[model samples]
Structure formats: C-alpha cells, structure tokens
Target: MTAGQVSNNGPKPLQRNLSRRVSFNEATLARSQEPPKPPAEPEFIDTEAQVVSRPPYSACCNSCCAWTSLVLAVLLLLSILVGGVYFAFLQSNLPQVRLHRLDVYYLEVNNTDTDTFLTSDLEVRLNFTNDNSKIKLSYSRMTASLTAEGVDLGTVTVPAITQEPSSSADVRARTWMRKTSAEEAVAEDLRDNSLKHLMVIDVVLKGHIDFLVNGNKMNGFPIKVSCRSIDQSEIDNGHAPKCGVQMTPL
Candidate 1:
C-alpha cells in the first residue's frame, strides 16, 4: 500500500474509538443528573407487616386478671353489706335479764383469837326474758358466787333454763358458807349488821347462752349477771332489785 493510504486508515479507526468513548460518557452523565429516581421509592415496605405480633396468651391473661379483680371487688362489697345487716339484727334483738328475788336463810359469826368464823346460807333468783318474737334462748349450767364486803362467802351451781320466744324464765341457786374465816374487824361489822337485820350481799352469775333463730342454733357466748348491794331490809319490804347483764362482745 502507499504511505498516504495507510495513514488515512489508521486515523479513521482512532476517530471511531473516540466517538464510542464520548457516547458512553454522555450516558453516565445523563443518568447522574436525573433527579436520583427518588431513592427507588423505598422498596414499598409495609411497617405493620414487619412489626412483631403480640402473643395470644398475653391478651387472654390480661382479660382474666380484669375479671378476677371485678369478682373480688363484688365479693368485698357483699361482705360489707352482709356484716352491716348482721350487726343491725344483733343490736335490735338482744335478750333481757334481771334479778327476781333474794333470800337469806341464816347468818352466824363466831370470834376466835386469830380470826373470825362465819357461816351463812343464802338463795338467789334470776329472771331471764326473751323479747324476740322469733328466737329462743337456752342457757348452760351456771355458777353463782356470793360476796359480802368484798369477801367471797360461797359459790353454788345454778341449773340451766330455756325460754321460748317472747317468754320469761327463772333460775334459782342456793349457796351455803360453812366455817368461813374472816378478819376480826370484818367479823365484828358483820355480827353487828346481822343483829340489826341490815346485812348486804352481792351475787355474780356466770354462764354461757345460745340462741335459736329460724330453727338454727347459733354459737354460744359467755354471759355475766351482777346483782349488787342486796339488803335484807329491801327483801323484807318486797322489793326486787334489777340486775345488770353483760355479754361477750361480737
């Protein structure tokens, strides 16, 4: 080939390569300037689908706890209401008791060098009244104690008694003080009072009582009856003193 023809062929191949490089650079530049394609629209991810679901047992447990709390609250309210009603019923329907009579059989006092000997016999009568129209009262065996001037004279057993609704009952107890000793001063006072027929004595009765309401027997409770300052003159004058009755607290 001639020298001019070879140079021309070489320059045409170089021009073709240059043109291809320019086309590739323009395509890259165009892609870089095209508003970045809005970051490919974030791949259309759903946030709710990605979140972890709660366990079924957890919801069930919460519901159960709520129901339990509600039930307990209801039970507490019912208990309070029932307690209030029971207390009211108790306050309105209490039994009535009193002393009916007192009797002195004999009293004797003897003096010695060191102490004084005393012997006495006495009887006590108590009246129990049940004012409740629908309830009955049953008393257990009781003990009666006799005291003269803060000195225990004797103790005796009293028989149990039952009273129907709106009815009254009486209990009698007899006590004998045998060969009891006392101080000289106390014996002198007792002897002087006995001679003058003006002796005073106190009686205390302790027992348990049960109530029957609507054919149901209730639990028993302790009871105390006190008859204080029973004078012989008052008994002679046909006056029956009223006694004080106390029961265990509910």
Candidate 2:
C-alpha cells in the first residue's frame, strides 16, 4: 500500500487500543471510589450448633454470691427471732412499786419567833413487785426525798435488794425534814385553817433497776418515783396512797 494509507490504518488500530485501555482504567477507578460495594453483608444461619457466650464471672463467683445471700438470710431470721422473744418475754413484763404504808410526825414545834424551825419524820414502806416469771430484778441503790410546797427536805437511803421472779420485796426508809426559812413557811402553809383540813406532801425516789436474764445482766437504767398530792388525812388514817413510777434516762 502507499505510505499515507499505511499511516492511516496504523493510527486507527492504535487509537482503538488506547480507547479500550482508558475505559478499563475508568471502570476500575469508579469501582474503587464507590466504597467497594459496602463489603457484602454476612449471611445469618439458624442452627443448634451455634455457640452462646457466657458471663465473665466463673462458677466460683456464682457460688460465693449464693453463700453470701444465704448467710444474710440466716442472720435476718435470727434477728427476727431474738426480737420476738424479747418482746414476748422481757418487754411485756415490767416491775411495779406500791406504797404500802406512810407516816409523818412533827417534832420540835415553836409557835414563837427564833425562825421557828420545823422537823418532820416520815416512815415509807414500799412494796417492790416483779411480775415477770423468768427475769429477776435487782435494785442496787435507792434514795428518796420529801418536799412540801416546792421546798426540798432531807434524803432517805435504802439498801440494795434483789427480787426473784413473781415475787415481792419490802423496802423501808425513814426520811426527815429540817429547814429554817422553808420549814417555817411550810409549817405556816400547812397550819392554815383552810389547808389544815386538806394537807398534801410530795415524795420523790431515784434509783436504778437491773434485769437478769439467762445469766446476762442489763443494767444502768434509771427509775423515777413520784408521790404527789398525798393527803395528810389519808396517811393519818393508816391508808396507803397511790403513786406513779416510770423508767427514765440517765
């Protein structure tokens, strides 16, 4: 063929080859830039042979937890039982005190001047009863005071005594009152015509009562005894008066 015709045919084959190579490179670049088709989602299969993961804690840890729970349950049960017993036995039964006999006497009376000191003596016979069938009561010490019209008198002390369950103990104390100004005032008030027929006195007792249960002693609890509005006529007639007692704090 001629030189021009050969050049034309050669260029046509070369151009075709170049066009095919460019198309292939463009397709490859487009596929790469399209995020690689999202990496093809994995297929899910349902089978019995599939594995299940367990918790990180081993069997030993599970056993420890169970034992801890059991111990706590046992402790709670014991606490409830002990509380029930205490309520039924110890808490329900309380001690009582009663005034069995009381007497008052006036001594060294002077209607004239010289301060007119008044002295009095009181005989207090108290019955201490323990109503509990299982617990024993111990009254370690006791001290009592007499008062009239807000004036404090001397104190009376009683020795220690222990009372068995369902038993009673007798407590005897002799209290005296001797004051100068207050005694004169009290005597004057008592001797008044209107009040002479209706005279009253106040008595206060302070002490500690301890409880013994199953060889254990629970003590340090305070007790207060208040005897107020004690009619002198009733005491003179040999009739015991009523009073109230309470458990108090230190």
Best by lDDT: 1
For model 2, the local distance difference test gives 0.71
Per-residue error (Å), model 1, residue 17: 65
Runs of candidate 2 with Cα error greater than 4 angstroms are: 1-92, 111-114, 183-185, 191-198, 235-239
- lDDT per residue (tens digit) for residues 93-177 in model 2: 5567666665555533345565666556667677777888888988767898776556555687879888999998888878776
Q: What TM-score do all the candidates reach, one by one?
A: 0.63, 0.56
lDDT (10s digit) by residue, model 1, range 202-233: 88888887878999987567777888888867
lDDT of each: 0.78, 0.71
- The count of residue-pair clashes in candidate 2 stands at 0
TM-score of 2: 0.56
